[model samples]
Target: MPFEHYKEVDLSSRNTLGLPSVSQYLGAFHSVSDLQHAFEFARNLSLPCFVMGGGSNILLPEYLPGLALLSSDRSIDIMGDEVTVGAGASWDNLVAETLKNGLFGLENLSSIPGTAGAAPIQNIGAYGVELARFVVSVEALDLQNGLAVTLTVDDCQFEYRDSLFKRHPERFVVTRLTLKLSTRFAPILAYQDLQRLPAQITESAEGLRRAIQSIRAKKLPDYRVFGNVGSFFKNPTLMKSVIQTLEQAQVLNSNTRSAQGKVSAAALIQAAELGDLSVGQAGISPKHHLVLENRGGATLTDVLTLAHLIQEKVERRFGVTLEIEPQQLTQLIHAPNPKG
Candidate 1:
């Protein structure tokens, strides 16, 4: 297929936030050959390419000046307990497929909204289980070399909601992901909500899947009905000394636990009584302090404004800075160092 056939596509449906935007150029690649051809087209035009998967984690501005590559291929293969999925494969689909095959490692990540290829970008995690634990390798198209390559888990540099893909956004476009899962029936019941689930001998992959879905349904707003990109900000990790100072001053909640002396950002936000704070169409979800939601027809500017306000309020109250989890498209507008 000619690359021109997929150029300048509207990206409203592609992104989860449903933000209306138009890419200067857009290309869809289903196979490795298609990806190579797309890259060639991009090179000829001298336009930077932005790779997008399910578009669950991004907030696109009203207008994008570069090419957007939408990965549409969705294929999966199972080798015993190991699963290899196409980059365009939905992450929630992988979780469901694993459970059907009696694999248990990904049950905790059920209902996450993104593609398998994007999981390692943020080391997508939930309920104490992270994608890094099961990732075997990642296949990506190296933009600089004009070839495809495979990266091991170590090469990805997995961290709390960060990885090599996120650190260097322009270097590679993920094409495929291989994950190592377990056929055994060991369920991870470590998170608070999971521990509260009723005990059952059938606590296998399927059981854990059901429990995770239930917990997410109760905690997170449905993206289909309500516009949201999951948790807006990451739970800030503070130094031990700073946590102690806040604890002594009664700024940190009593229920907050120490992560080697670091306090939870959720606890701190709730302690500061900013749980239901709102600014125009944006507000912090009263149900969960970590989530910032767009009530309706909210623009990217509104979201960023509320986020900055929340960060400033938190920092002024506790002297700890909060980092946003989702990728921001308009960081240039807020040029001041957020740490300030």
Candidate 2:
């Protein structure tokens, strides 16, 4: 299809967080050629461009000033145990498809929202399995020259909830991803809840995926039901010495402490007594302390206000600064950063 651009597009329902926004110019691209053309269009107009996928990991302002591009290329190809997926492909669908084909590497990552391109950007993790472990390479468009390039896993610089794409948001527009899956059943049950699963469940790929889906369903609010972008804060991984100091001071609760010296951000927020905390219509999710929710008709400012309050309280109570997890359109918006 020819490249099409629209003006004054409403994006309230586009984002999982449900923040209302109106883009100055918006384009949806279905192929690599269309993607490059969109970038060129933005450049020719001297307008700043923002590329979005799935709209699951971003907070948009009331009115965006430039071009907004959405990836709509949803396609997947499986070669033996290796799967090369389009950036716009649903992440959960990829997991489901792989498992149905007897693949095992993605079971622990089941039920995650967003697209394949976003997976490596955030190094998305759950139930102890991270996307970084299975990624072979990422294909992206370098907007500088409107050229397509392939990036190796090492080149992506994956870290805890961060990557090279995140650090340099303007440089790469992820178009496709190639992941190396496995036919062998190798389950990772290191996370606390996953460890509690029965041997019958843990022994199989589909069984483990179901167990994780059940666990997440109980702990996290579905974006469809409640306006949210999943976890709002990254779990803080600290030095053992720092954890010991907090423990001695009786500041770190038992539930927050992990064997690897990481503390749950949710536990810290709860410790600060910020559960059910709200600003305007934005509030913390009662189901999971880590999530910030929009009760209804919430603004971007309201969400930021609530997030600031949480950070202030957690820092005051535990002396740890909580970092935000999602990418945002505004300057004040907190993009995912390394855990403190």
Candidate 3:
């Protein structure tokens, strides 16, 4: 099959942040064949390629020098409690559909942007659940030899906001994911916010989903209104000793613990007086300090500058380094159309 390829592509609106980017070559792959073909096309030219889905958790450079492959397949198959979803399927749609079918485990993850394929890469989580808990397996193409491989949950090596795929990004391109959900309702009320859920809405899947959705809507800035890529920094995790030091110094608030040894990044940033901070058109969201917004005409440089400023302030004030959550790309080869 001949793969469709385009050149000089404008991706200003592709990313949730609405940053302007131009690719020299862009390939839209709709099937396994198309995906492989596009990769081979880039390989032939010895150009670096970057695979993207839904354009959510990424920071792209102003110019991509090589191929930008987009996974656009959207297929979902359900069998009992097991679901096999295409990488390109809408993540929110998956959450909504699973609840509609009486599946339980995904309700807490509702309303996250990006495609199904991108979830496990960051071990995407929210409210009190992580995608790793439901992922049965992942199918990926080994870009090294153009072969396919399946990785079980244990092989994923999921840790706070990270996975093996994120660690070895150049080695594999994910194709699909299989998730094992539950037929019974079991809401996780461990999160402080969820613990406050009204009694009337705590028993059913739909109700829990709606409640989580409402909370996210109220707290997070709508990317449409003020462009952003959700949480801009990973919640900085500290060792027990380090946390104790910060606590003694009174740099963190009393209600900052998230897990046995972790604290909330937002709280630290807020404590450091980094909220509502700005650098050019990029500014920290006033509603949520962890979100960096594209106020308008924000450039990649502006975003990075603001991010650095935040990092410096948070670190100087709290002695903990703030790590960026989104993946950053200096450049990915997107070659020009040969026939053009």
Candidate 4:
């Protein structure tokens, strides 16, 4: 069956930042067949395909004149300690479901937004746990050749906030994720926030999940209220010599370190005193320096302006460049041709 496609789809409500945007064409990939059908449509029209996840980690432009795809293959199957989930499956839902079924590893990543397929791309980590540690393999379609292939953890080349998929956005689409979880509850409470929790909160798998969720709730803005994409910048990881250089320059603290002993991006922004900075409706989140909030009625330019300001100020002060965590539409996909 041919895939059904739509045109001029409104995407303002699709992204977490609530930027007003529109896609020239839109479709869903229910299965591999659907994927081929959608690509055929785009191929015939000479339009590039852009995949949209839960809309949690993307920045959309005002108009996208190509095909915008959303994965709808929300399939989940559990066999022993291995769990397989479709690309469209909600990440939080997967975490909750696995925990309910006695799987214990994803408890630390409790409330992360976006889909399961998007998890491996970023090697999403939180509370001392990384998705790469649990990922058995990633079932993806190599768009460059239109073939399905399963990528091993090594093939993924997992790094802090980056992976092969992330590096080459147009090459592959994650169709499914296979994770090897554990029945035994091994709680990881090494993060600074988790460290503050009492013993009871960290005693059980569920307890740790709820505690982490609560902590995130207090720090992160409700997208419904103030649109945001969690942390907007990745923490900067540097070599020991770089750290010493920064410390000597007074741009970094000798003690304030983040995961993998990297300097915290949030700390750098806070030290730059960018909390009160804003461009129109876009502002630096006072609650968390790493988050850039879209106060309703904000445009993409507003957000970009504010982000640029933060980057400029932080870099001016710390001599460290803060990399944007979320993928921008322009960066992720080929520019859509208005002529088409």
Highest-scoring model, lDDT: 4
TM-scores, all candidates, are 0.91, 0.93, 0.94, 0.94
Model 3, residue 131: displacement in angstroms?
A: 0.5
lDDT of 4 at 262: 85
Candidate 1's error at 96, in angstroms?
Answer: 0.8
Candidate 4 stretches with Cα past 4 Å from truth are 241-255, 334-340
Tens-digit lDDT track of model 2 for 144-205: 56668899999999998999988888677888999999889988987878878899998889
CA lDDT scores, all candidates in order: 0.77, 0.84, 0.85, 0.86
Candidate 1 deviant stretches above 4 angstroms: 253-255, 329-340
lDDT of 3 by residue, 199-286 (tens): 8898888898899999999999999898899999988778888888878877665578755767888888887887778988999899
TM-score winner between candidates 1 and 4 = 4
lDDT, candidate 1, 173-240, per-residue tens:
78889999987777778676777777772356777788788879988877676667887778777777
Ordering by lDDT: 4, 3, 2, 1
Candidate 4: what lDDT? 0.86
Per-model tally of clashing residue pairs: 0, 0, 8, 0
For residues 133-181, could you state the per-residue lDDT of candidate 4 as single tens digits?
9988999877767778899989999998899999989788889989999
Q: How far does residue 168 in candidate 3 sit from its true spot (Å)?
A: 0.6
In model 2, where do residues sit more than 4 Å from their true spots? 253-255, 331-340
TM-score of structure candidate 4:
0.94
Give the higher-TM-score candidate: 2 or 3.
3
| Steric clash pairs (candidate 4) | none
lDDT accuracy of residue 335 in candidate 4: 31
Model 3, residue 265: what's the lDDT? 87
* Model 3 worst lDDT window (10 residues): 331-340
